[model samples]
Target chain A: MHDYTMPFGPQHPSLKEPINLALELDGNYITGVKMRFGYVHRGVEKIFEGKDVQKVLYVAERVCGICSYAHSSACTRAMEGILGLEAPTRVKLLRTIVAELERLHSHILWAGFGLHEIGFQSMFMLFWRERERVLDILEAITGGRVHHNYNKLGSVRYDLPKGCEELMRKNIAELEENLPGLIKEFEKNSVVLARFKKVGKISRKDAITYGLVGPMARGSGVKSDIRKIDPYEAYDDIRFNEILEEGGDAYARAKVRLTELGESISIIKQCMSLLPPKPAEKWKWPPIKTGEGFGRVEAPRGEDFHYYEIEDNIVTRGKIRTPTLANIMILEKMLIGAEIGDTPVIVASFDPCIGCMERTMVIDKGKKNWFTESEFRRKFCD
Target chain B: MKRSPWISHYNASSCNGCDLEILACLTPRYDVERLGIVLRESPRHADILLVSGVVNMQNKDRLKRVYGQMAKDKYVIAIGACGISGGPFHEGWNMAGPVDKVIPVDMYVPGCPPRPESIINAIAKLLEGLE
Candidate 1:
């Protein structure tokens, strides 16, 4: 068969976000993959420069909706680190609760997408149905569902509303009750197992070499979860297991996320009980004089890091490194030898946030004499 | 409406807030399908182009292309704050403008990321306007 190039995206159904994948196909197998990003670049990093430390938090949260709370927390923590500001124990616990909730919702959302990619519509519905309860918990705590804007400079935006703990406890119980059955079905389903079991396999060494983070690394048995390694917020005070799998395939990645969902629930429950007496709102942010610091959080997809340099309350330089940016490069390796049919499944397995990953790209066609637009119009529009 | 409206979603330089909410709109809680709204993958078959996010330089042309591909008498619902007025990233060097500047938007659903119910209301209003 002749080698042919198939452009997969920019706007394709298989992709939940915009990403252009130039796939070199030899019959059913993909021989090469060229990725073009920046289809969704809103100039987030550029926008961060010269913004007030207070307002930058909102912009940070908007970096990616799935991990909005995490990004916001990371931004706040970065500012706090620079100013030597430490939030009270209760504020730390509250931040942890919201962050874990963000993790649960993001993981469940990805699971649903995974099921959808594999042609399991009913399973997708089931996953999302359970996810709504998680969203309810989020809505109860933070005002908005997706853009929670819950993180402030030194403390979170809101305290747990009345009965919020009981509500969370009840929701956690319901999720714990339902997740096992979902996992059992996912594991037993032959079609799901067939499509994902050994597909897009990555070795532990390769995962490290590719700089994979979050579940993508944990799936390959690399104990690289930043939460456990470098505990932040209330992570040091809380106890939770770092979920891992040794299979290093798409199935393993899914398993890691599913298991981590339970871990997130448990962490939230622990955080709720450990809440300190002082209200979170009482903690205030100190005036930013001049300093630089880095903050990192274990976001749903993986490690999310933010580094900033502030001079007189304005962020002179700010850098955010989201997990998808760390994990997306590995797709080039994973998709090289996979079948065309498995492209979407393998890509979805990474749970890539292309919106966060897109930087900038200019499509340069060079000096080649291609057919002009007028030539095409003259040929076809006559 | 004579037939179910098939909708196609386009994310033109969004932060994914509006995009995820659009996904949630289809899930069990919202179950937009009950409104005779089908989510189609291809732009050609879609009756309503559900656009989320601001129009950036790179995606502006792509968004316009997708809009042009839709059938005649189609409607465009610009969802989210970014879609309506470019929101926080309005001053970015890469952004061209909001959705309406590039394409003819019929209805606007405004939120940082509008709720699923809000999206449904926008759809209902669009249908009402169509009548």
Candidate 2:
């Protein structure tokens, strides 16, 4: 076997994010993996400097479009904590609703991508089609599917749109009814199980040592959901079980996501049922004077934390630690010793937001040319 | 209707908003392919070059190369707030400026990052212009 180096992305279909994973291989097996990120870095933190505390929400959300609301929520919560203010009950409920809705969309989207990576095109299409329902519900409520910016410092920007409850009920009911079928399809499919089951195993010890969070950690048998541990918003009000799998493989991660999708629907139903009556008084709070704060939210991928430094109501410094950042470390670990052919499946299992992961520079080795999709496709197919 | 344009997407220096929306337009929901628009990774294989993000000095040369590599009669659509103007990140020293400063833009779709529908509409207008 000859020693070969392969660059995985910056622009490859297998990689959802713009990361370049240079795998040094001896024949088909990966001996070593070099990871490079920042291809998608927009220098958002640098731009946040000197912006008003309120305005930083926009920049923060832009950090990861898939997890936009989670980032914004984290920022707002951090700011709220700094100002020594707690959001109104109604506002907290609304935030929880939006956050859970985001999780539904993100997880479904990931499931779709995972299917697609393994050549299950029909499953991919079906999952994305279903995800559209979540997007529509989000759009109906916040007027934007991806970047809602609905979470403001003190409260949300707008009240629930007309028919919002009915919409939630319809979607949640539909999702709940359909989830068993989807799970059955996944379980019965030998190819899916063969490809994913125990493909990328992350042990409990390694997961804890890495400090991984979200479904990735839970998949590895680590009960570390921020929602369960640090119950925020309506999470405390609703009774829901944290989905877990002990396999810590690709299949386990997928199963965790699939189960959470069902849980998210139930949580949404509870929210709709417990939604408070429309308050007469508009929610308002005094602006910040001088304070620094940190907020953590469980995004679909994992725990997303935002730290902010405010001086005189203006953001002096803002730093966001997206779940993908934490997950990326674990992904590199999973890639080691895996067959190069399983790269896409391994990469997709992390559900990496390349938009978030592409923050590293692509170092040119000058030996092998930049990786193209065709070359990758041929290699994988072969 | 006669000739659907071949589109190429380039990320200069952006927050990925415009890029995701552009992809959304290409997906089954918007299905820009129905209009004969296909997202080609290679610039040489495209008819309409979709540029996203603010032009930074590091990426300026690559942007120009991609633009220059396109076949004649190719259209350039500057999508999103960053490409149309300098956008929010325009004031930085490292930023080379807006897409217009480096290349002639055939169309501009504005939004902090334009929505998928807006991107579809921009493509429709560009196709109509080509006809």
Candidate 3:
């Protein structure tokens, strides 16, 4: 029984974010694991305390660069609900198109990283090469790739650019053609299947208890999707199945995302076909006297929820709960009693967005002076 | 082709916009390693320091210390609207403003969070200027 504590990160190559995981090892087996965050805090939620509702939308979007559009959409939807205003049909459809596009790009990006984590460079490269097409489409439409500030308070800031529909159709066609081959490769690939299957198993019961959402929960046979449950934007009109897997392992999660990519393509096609004849003339930019609202959207990772309170047209209180936040809890649960070697794969499998997780800033109330990940884990878990 | 460049990243109290994009470049999409650019976590191993976010008092000293630790001939490429200017956090009581106030910057990539392509382009431009 060799008792040694191994520090995983705050700055580790395997980790994408500044998360520190303290693993108490019993000779290569992780007997106990603790996860700590907040190394990249920017006080985003605190800043939203006293700002105009419109201005707060901008700040909320900046909460996470990868899921910026999702956050903005959630925030705007909440604000719209509070103001009792519905965006024009055209605006709603456009938002859905952008969101589904974001999903396509994000899922591909995550899949590439998951492959890279398991020492699969070729798969990583291939996935990213396909991702570039999505980025090009986004850049063509929104004039920016990652953080497209396209979602305004009532409607989108920019409408579809010239030949945008044709461009989307072409990209979608390419993805549709190439995706089956990639799926076949992923299915037949021993390396991917061996590492991912049954690696990070979380039962459906535990998933619900730990509050897991999106693909992570769905992978465990939990039928929970914000779009299906809540039905915001054009999601209500679109006909697509929520991809799910009974096995709650890393491979199941990966499969869920891979299948959803096809669903995303379908959703996009529906949006394109159902796209309104013309953009809205003037969207409802109603005033907010004083009220509170909640908005939730299904992001690439999971369900992203934004809570906001408006007073005199200013955002008095705003709090964001990203999918990563929910998924991190499940990560800790899944990591305990697991081998140390599977750390990176398990962590990357959830597609944990550090940008979203670092929103929680702990003040460290002078108990230890140094708030290590191990200590936080012990405090929270115990 | 000859210069083996070492790059360090600085998070001077940012919203993690530029930071993610910087990492994106290191990934397969842009793959900065193909251009002989290596992202070193420590400033001591760096030939170029990439700064992201607005400089605030809390992290200002840490930023200066990291910059000072780097070896000479080190270039600074400011990524994102927040790094070049204060961005959305421009006017706050406990703010120190942009990266230029603390350290000299060589290039600027301007976007709320500049896309990975833009960052790759900026790094390319930086390498060209270095040559």
**Residue range B69-131, candidate 1, lDDT tens digits:** 988988999999999999999987678899999999999998999999999888888877777
* Comparison by DockQ, 1 against 2, better one: 1
lDDT of each: 0.87, 0.79, 0.81
- In candidate 1, stretches whose alpha carbon ends up further than 4 angstroms from where it belongs are A280-285, A362-382, B1-3
- TM-score for all models, in order of appearance: 0.95, 0.89, 0.89
Model 3 clashing residue pairs (backbone): none
Q: A1-382, model 2: which lDDT tens digit per residue?
A: 7899998765565654445689999899998988765445556766787898777887778777788888888888888889877777787788888888999988888887788889997777677767778888998889887778897777789999889778877877777777678778987899999899879899999999998888889999999899988988778989999998999998999999989887887787788778788767677755658978899988888888888899998888777788878877877778888998899998888887765654333335468746574763364223
Model 3 lDDT at residue A339: 85
lDDT of 3 by residue, A1-382 (tens): 7689999875566665566789888987888887766555666776787788888887788777777889989998898889887788888888898898899988988888898898897887788778888988888888877778887777788888899888988988898888788877887899998889889999989998998989999999998899999999988888999998999999999899999999998888898888878853775567647888899999888899989888888887778888988888777677788888899999898888876876555544666555575775465324
- Which prediction has the highest lDDT against the true structure? 1
State the lDDT of candidate 1 residue by residue for A1-382, as single tens digits.
9999999998898788898999999999999999888889887877888899988998998889888988898888888888777877888898888899889889989988998998899999999999999999999999889988887767777887889778888988999999889988988999899999999999999998998999999999998888888888999988899998999999999999988888888898898888877562565557758988899988898999999989988988788888999998888988998999999999999999988787544434456535564753363224
Between which residue pairs do clashes occur in model 2? A17-A354, A37-A359, A37-A360, A38-A358, A38-A359, A38-A360, A39-A358, A40-A358
- Sort all candidates by lDDT, best to worst: 1, 3, 2
Give the per-residue Cα lDDT of candidate 1 at B86: 90
Q: Candidate 2's error at A124, in angstroms?
A: 1.7
